[model samples]
Target: MHQLSLLGTGLIGMFYTQSLHQYQPGVRVAHVYSRRKERAEKFAADWDIPRWSTDLDAAINDPHTDTVLIGLPNHLHKTAILKAAAAGKAILCTKPLAMNAAEALEVLEAVEAAGVFHGYLEDLCYTPKTLKALQAVQNGALGQVLWTRSREAHPGPHSDWFWDPTRSGGGAIIDMGCHCIEIGRNFIGKQVQPLEVVCWADTLVKPIDAEDNAVGLIRYESGALSQFDVSWTYRGGMDLRDEVAGENGTIRLDHWLRTGFELFTETGMGGYVAEKAESETGWLFPVGDEVNALGYVHMFRDMFEAMDAGTAPMETFYDGYVVNAIMDACYRS
Candidate 1:
């Protein structure tokens, strides 16, 4: 069994640890670290972690730690990843990998230089409905992919670091919008290079330097156009909706529909509503805390297996760099 060390004890860390226990039983969270000693201890107790520490060195260098899962803020990602790489630990890092593309390059350089296995953690790809949508797009069930859109918005992150520009990067776009961008690129099988982008940021409630809302338009290398909107000011719970338009059909996915696809076919009269796609049992856990937790379960298991098989996992550090580069360009607009 591979042993894992987790950095940061925030919500993502909590859910990640829980999912590690629930889904990937063979993997063990042997150590945890946080600036807040009490938070580390709390997660240790809640998840039955064997070791907890406030020192980065201790957690990264622990004898039992074969891999490090970074759940820290955007700015801190570079520090944690470099430290783990230097310590000779394989890495599984959370999304929007760095403060910007340049920083992401630094992380990539460190990973390559250290000769370590690195993967970018993104729940967007692991979600059940997304998996189905990816299949539909790939199978040509949705022919001639024309346009796509995805949105992930929440009522601001609970962490103070997430609110700080220096720490969290740009805010809503970096935090929530990257997921949409990654998904769109993956589903359409296209390289997303923004031709023209326009973004507007707003500070709704948080006192941080980053924008609370952002929107952008992107043109893929495959000639597909996509637009996205993200916000930290939304009053409701986490909301994500995505749609794809094609020559023959359209596919729509929403959080409410769980792990199923809603298909619309082209008919002689007009667009005809077709059958609904069904997902396997336990394909998607309950939304909110449970949804996140389940995603990490798949995330870690795949990381471990890919490492053992000597293959890169679903999202590589390069993928992180691509998404960050696009976002950095959008921020410049």
Candidate 2:
């Protein structure tokens, strides 16, 4: 059994706990932590965790927990990683490991030096359709992947911190571009180094300092190009789509827009329809199982199973660092 010290009482924390408890048997959230005492208590009570604390270190140092799942804000990632590594605990961190490449490198070095198992929680790459497509690409179903495109756009994030440049780093790129960039790496090849990045970002719609809409192109050493576009100005619900073109064939994945299940309610469902849904009254796209649909189920399975087998999971801290580097380049360009 893998006992986890879950950090943060936010949306990501909730999803991670749901996947660990509701789906994965024997995997338990031994402890939960939140900056606010009330949130910590509520999260622990809601998830039935044995212990809860507002002190991050106390939670990480829990003797019963062997792993630390970090779902905290972007600015807090470095502190959590360093503390978790120092405590000699396996760490699983959320996307965009740090605010930028330099910070990401520092945390990555700390984890490597501490010799702890670390996994990058990039859930979109573990989606069922993306997993199958990755397998097919590895099997040479599509010759050499030459070009890939991944787009993830929605109204905006649910948290207030995400809009603050100091807290969340940049805007749309940091929020959603990390997902697209890593998806490209999986489709093309992680071994192929990204050569250059050119991006166009602007604060078009959102009343924020950071860019609200952005598009970027990452050129790889093998001449493959990964294209991505992220926006907070999108009016409709979340739109997630990906495309890969190789020498011989091509593949496409549309996750949210045309998700097999769709519902239209004239009045409203009187409940949450989906993540980042603009409206619950018009056409609602409610996921049957968010934990499964969001790729948390498969992702946790891979992380814990790899721990048992003494092997590295598909996504690691290195991948997260690389994505951060690409993001830094995007901002630079």
Candidate 3:
């Protein structure tokens, strides 16, 4: 059994724990950790976890835990990952791995040197819609994936750290662009090296040091061009969409906004409508199952299965590093 030590009590951490418990077999979050004692204790209790701690090291070094899932803020990713690596624990970390390509390189090297199983927790790349699109590409339904685009926009991140550039590393480009860049990489192919990048970004809406809006283009060695558009100023709700084109055919996906299961409610939709929904009493796209729809279930399942079989999951720290490097180039451009 893969007993995991989850090192965050935030929304991401909850999704990770929930996915492991309900979706994956032979996997459980053995320990929960939070910066706050009460949150740590409450998270543990809510999830029926055996242990909780306010201490980062104590939580990571939990002997009962064989795997460490780092769901902490962007700034703390490197430290927690380094700690987990030192403990010889299998590590799974959320993106963008570190503050920049340099930090991401350090993280990548540490995990490689430790020779531990590492998976990059890029859930957007594993969504059901994305998986199906990738399959169609692999099956040659879409010929050569020459051009691709992915766009992710929402109000903004939930936590305060995101608003701080020093902590978050960047603004919308780093926050949501990580997802879009990686999604483009998926369609363009990972093995094919990215040759060039050109981008434009500005803090058009939010008053922050980091840019709240960005658009980037990457050219692959195979002459494929992938473009990404990311923003935190989008008002209506979260918009997750992607398009892929090839010599043979094309594929279009609408992940969140236009999901078939839609409802119009006069009164608030009881409670939560979806991840980034602004209104409860309107035409809403209430996700049937947020965890499953967001690809947490697929992601965790693939992670544990790969861990068990001693194989690499679809996403690794190296992939994260590549995406960070591309983001760095985009930011510089």
Candidate 4:
């Protein structure tokens, strides 16, 4: 069994622990940590973890902990990953990797230098609907690709750290855009080195300097022009959708809704197919049946299997780097 340590007692951290306990029977969250000692203790009590530590190093150095899951805020991603690497523990870092590409690269370098396995936890690509869409596209059902668009956003996150630019990265784009951007890359099976990205962002909630809404256009190396609308101020409720167009047909995936694919062909031949995305195949998480993969359990499971085989999971530090780099460029643009 793989022993895991989790940093940060925030919502994501709590959800990850719950999922690990519920879905990943092969893994155990041996230690739980928070900057606040009391909170760490409480979290441990709630999760029934064996130990709690306010000192990040202690958790990293814990003898039973072979894997470290960094669920901290975006900026802390680099620091925690680096500390875990220094302790020789494999790492599973939360999405966005870091506030920007440069920091993401630093984390990648640290993991490589330590010769430890590491993966970026970008959940959207693992969502059931997305895997289905990717298969449809690959099977020529979607024809030659024309463009792809993905959007992931929700009314502002409940965490205070989410509103802080220094802590959460840059609001909705980093909070949510990373998912869409990475999903796009996974769908196309190529790098999305944005030739240019134009962005417009706004802040309407509270007094934070971070943006609550953003719209961006990205040109990928595959000659695909992607558009995204991410926001913390949507009144229509949370949504995550990706539409891929091809010469013969177009495929649409609604990730959060778990709806199956909608294919529209040029000759007006269109249909809807219901699939669990993974039910028909022995595909693992991020590739097969939903299996109620809520928190990071599926992600960890995928990573562990990949590690044993000496291969990287679907989403890696490089994937996170590409998303953040695009986000940074959009912010600058």
Candidate 5:
């Protein structure tokens, strides 16, 4: 069995833990680390983790830890990845890789030098709906792909640090645009190179240094176009939608708005329905097994299997670097 140490106890971290415990029985979260002692202790207890610590190095250096999964803030990704790489532990990091492509290159070099397994957790591309869409496109359901668009928007980020551009790297563009861009690229074919990017960004909702609303268009060498719009000002619940158009046919997907279960409440329902959901009361589209729906379960399971087989998973540090490079161009544009 592969024992893992998890860095960060925030929303994403918790979701990853839950998914691993539920789906990937071959791997276990043996230790968890948080910058705050109290939060770490409570989170470990809540999740029934074997150990908890405030020192990230201690967690990564643990003798039992075969892999280190990082779900920390954008700024801390490079440091944590390097430490885990030095310890010769397999590494799985959340999206965007690093603050920029330069930082991502540092991580790529360290992991390669250490010869450790690595995976990039870009869940949006792994969603069942997305996989189906891509397969259809590949099967010639969409002949000669012309354009693709993806949107991921919510009221805002769950944490305060995301408001600081220095910490979270940009606002909605880097935060959610990464998902849109990657999914679009997947539809356009990974081998295709993005030639140029045109973008427009602004702070439309929250008062933050980074943008709250943004749109970007990527022109590829194959003469295909991929565009995305992200925002932090959308009301109601989270919005995750995508579209792909080709000469023969078109594909449209609504990930969040799809209703497997719906309810109408007079007073208010209990708990949360989805991430960034304003209220659980009234008309609700409550998703069953959000971890499964969001593709976290499949992602971790595949990562563990890939590590065991000594092979790379669907997404890797190199993919993260590419997305970051593209986003950097978008910011510049």
Candidate 6:
């Protein structure tokens, strides 16, 4: 089994840990590090991890750790990645690799100098629906992909720090836009690189420095177009949808609304339905296994297997870097 050291005990970190436990028997969380000692200890005990620490170095440098997964804030990603690379640990980092292309380049250089396995955890690309859609596209069901559109919107982030542009980068464009942009690129195929980007962003709901809603368009080298919309002011719940149009056919995926299970509650279920579900007393999507459905389980599983095989996974730091660069350009536009 690959023993992993997890940095951060936030929402994403907790979800990743549970996913590893539930779906990946070949991987185990050996250590956990949180900013707070109490939180680290509690997470370690709750997840049955062997070690916990408030010191980042201790966790990354642990002898029992085979890999390090970073789920920290945007500004802290560079430091964590560099430390993990210096420790010669394989790395799997959450999305939006760095705050900007410059920071992403530093991360790229560090990992390359260390020659450690690295994977970028862009879970949306690995979701079942997305996978199926891409497969069909690859098989020429779409003929020639001419344009693609993807969106990810929610009321806002779970943490207060996300509101601070200094900590979390821009706003909705940098937050949810990262996912939509990557999804658009994935649907368009890797053979074509993004050549140009234009964006419009503004804050409408949240009283933050970052934009609450944003829209961007990307032009690929192959002359295809990718359009994306992201927002933090969206109500009802998390909305994830994508559309791809080609010369021969078209495909659409409504990730949240097209659920297999639904429940109507009068007094609420007294539990969670899905991520960012606004209410439990109304018609609920009631995601069966959110970790699996949202592709965290698959992401970790594929990452561990790729590390074992000494090969790059589907997504890597390079991919994350590209996404950051594109987002940087969009912000400038």
Give stretches of model 6 more than 4 Å off: none
Q: Could you tell which candidate, 1 or 4, scores higher by TM-score?
A: 1
**Residue-wise C-alpha lDDT for candidate 3, range 1-333, written one tens digit per residue:** 889899999989988888889888789998998999999999999999999999999999998889999999899999999999999999999988899999999989999999999999999999998999998898899789899999999999889899998999999988988998898898888889998999999989887898988999999999999999998999989999999999999999998998888888897767878899989987888888889888899988888889889999999999999999999999889
Q: Candidates' lDDT values, in order?
A: 0.79, 0.93, 0.92, 0.76, 0.91, 0.90
Q: Rank the candidates by lDDT, best first.
A: 2, 3, 5, 6, 1, 4
lDDT of 6 at 272: 71
RMSD, candidate 1, Å: 8.6
TM-score of each: 0.87, 0.98, 0.98, 0.86, 0.98, 0.98
TM-score of 3: 0.98
Per-residue error at 308 for model 3, in Å?
0.7
lDDT of 4 at 236: 35
Off by over 4 Å in 5: none
Q: Score residue 35 of candidate 1 by CA lDDT.
A: 88
- Model 1 TM-score, 2 decimals: 0.87
User: For model 5, how does the per-residue alpha-carbon lDDT over 224-322 read when each residue is reduced to its tens digit?
Assistant: 999999999998888999999999999999888674677888677767677777886778778877888787977887788888898999899988999
The weakest ten consecutive residues by lDDT in model 4 span: 272-281
- lDDT (10s digit) by residue, model 2, range 1-333: 889999999999999998888889999999999999999999989989989998889999999899999999999999999999999999999998999999999999999999999999999999998999999999999999999999999888889999999999899999999999999999999999999999999999878889999999999999999999999988788999999999999999998878888887899998878888888786777888877877999999999999888889999999999999999999999
Model 2 off-target regions past 4 Å? none
For 74-147, candidate 4 gives per-residue lDDT tens digits of 77888789889998988998887998989988888889899998898886677555766788877889676768
- CA RMSD, predictions in order: 8.6, 0.9, 0.9, 8.6, 1.0, 0.9
Clash totals for all candidate models: 0, 0, 0, 2, 0, 0
The alpha-carbon lDDT assigned to residue 129 of candidate 5 equals 86
* lDDT comparison, 1 vs 4, better candidate: 1
lDDT of 1: 0.79
